[model samples]
Target: MRPTRAGTIQDAVARCYRAAGGVEAVAEQLGLANSTVSYGTEINEARPGGIGVNHLARLAMTDPDCALPLAEFFAALAGGVYQPVGGVAEVISLFSGCGLMAKECGEAQAATILAATTQRPKDIAEAEREIEEAIAALTKSRAVLTSLQSGAA
Candidate 1:
């Protein structure tokens, strides 16, 4: 099973600190105190209370290379999966990925009908409509992301 969002965030904090050398080094880079960074990187079930939102924002804003990873880290914390691409968060890309999956599911249903099961056309049509709804959801999600990116959401 996958780790919870809190666990993922903790892991990311530790990984980020390691990437920057150590807690001290990361603190120096992030313009924060060593104790703060140390507390944030500690493994725990809840979020690192020591690392405030402002601190996290500053880390992403100041460190270009760490920006998207930090965004993904935050997204995971919010129960969303936003992968990084070229140091940028590919939020819109998630919609595209879901669209592809829905398309494939529709196609799979058709293939399955041809191959074995004696499922009724209504069943196949219902599955296809469900996939269509998923595609529609992707479209709506993409629109919302676009609006957010354009500072209109």
Candidate 2:
């Protein structure tokens, strides 16, 4: 199965730390103990939990973009994806994007039908790529609709 764009928590946390200018800078920025940030950014096979929500919030307050991947990391666990919606402009874009999303769905459906009974490896691979593209479009549309539903944009 394809991994989510959010990647693993280790990946997300490390990205945040990197964006905040590495462990020491992040620790200083967030007023955290050096050990805490060090532990938080530790790359490991174990699940991530060294960072607290409050610290994350503080970090996010200063560098919002840095936290987005981490938000996506958790959202994907709940079978959802996170997209930043910048109120009116994004809302306008979402509506416009819907038309393109519909086109993608049609393309996906055609590809799936074409590959349905095919035994050829290449054909199947092409269909898989098409379907993934369509899925991404649909997921974006869904997120847009969800934001509207929640009055977020």
Candidate 3:
């Protein structure tokens, strides 16, 4: 996955947290920016609390097997490949395990979860839509490729 620019201060803080290894690490690495990292971490910790109407709708559109790659993809984004945050390695580790199923629990659901935990919404609905669309297109393309290969054989 390609890296995305850190769109919000929260995104920047998350990047810092990942780079520094949790909130404390981020603070020390950034030279006394601990409070910022701590604040960001606290906000992010509240996103998983509730279910929303949009979340349920998105959930209805998802498949079960697509979560791991999605998480890894998002982790990659958070790791600052494009944006170059301070402590990306740590961020990658933290986000790498978010399975697709967990990640795909619908945009609103995911947002709600994130909001519940972190008190901030990551605005992942657009990304989720694109991913789902991409997955479908890829699956179709793969099926076509397989068919062509078998036919040629």
Task: Return the TM-score for each candidate structure.
Answer: 0.45, 0.62, 0.21
Q: For candidate 3, what is the TM-score?
A: 0.21
* Tens digit of per-residue lDDT, candidate 1, span 69-115: 56677787789866323211333565675775577667656755654
Candidate order, TM-score descending: 2, 1, 3
Which candidate has the top score in lDDT?
2
| Stretches > 4 Å off in candidate 1 | 1-8, 43-47, 85-153
* Model 3 ranges with Cα > 4 A deviation: 1-122
The pairs that clash in candidate 1 are none
Question: Model 2 over residues 1-153: C-alpha lDDT tens digits?
Answer: 112234666667777777787888888898888887777655544635467667877887899877886788888999987755444443257757788778887887787777887757887888888877777676666667887799975
In lDDT terms, how accurate is model 1? Answer: 0.61
The window of 10 residues in a row where model 3 has the poorest summed lDDT is 81-90
Task: Give the residue spans of candidate 2 off by over 4 A.
Answer: 1-11, 42-48, 80-98, 119-125, 139-153
Residue-level lDDT of model 3, residues 1-153, one tens digit each, is 112234543444344335334556534544545454355433343542122224222322452222223333356767822212222222222233233224444543555555556653354554546456444433344444455578731
Return model 1's CA RMSD, one decimal. 8.9
Candidate 1's TM-score reads 0.45
Candidate 2: 10-residue stretch with minimal lDDT = 1-10
Task: Judging by TM-score against the true structure, name the best candidate.
Answer: 2
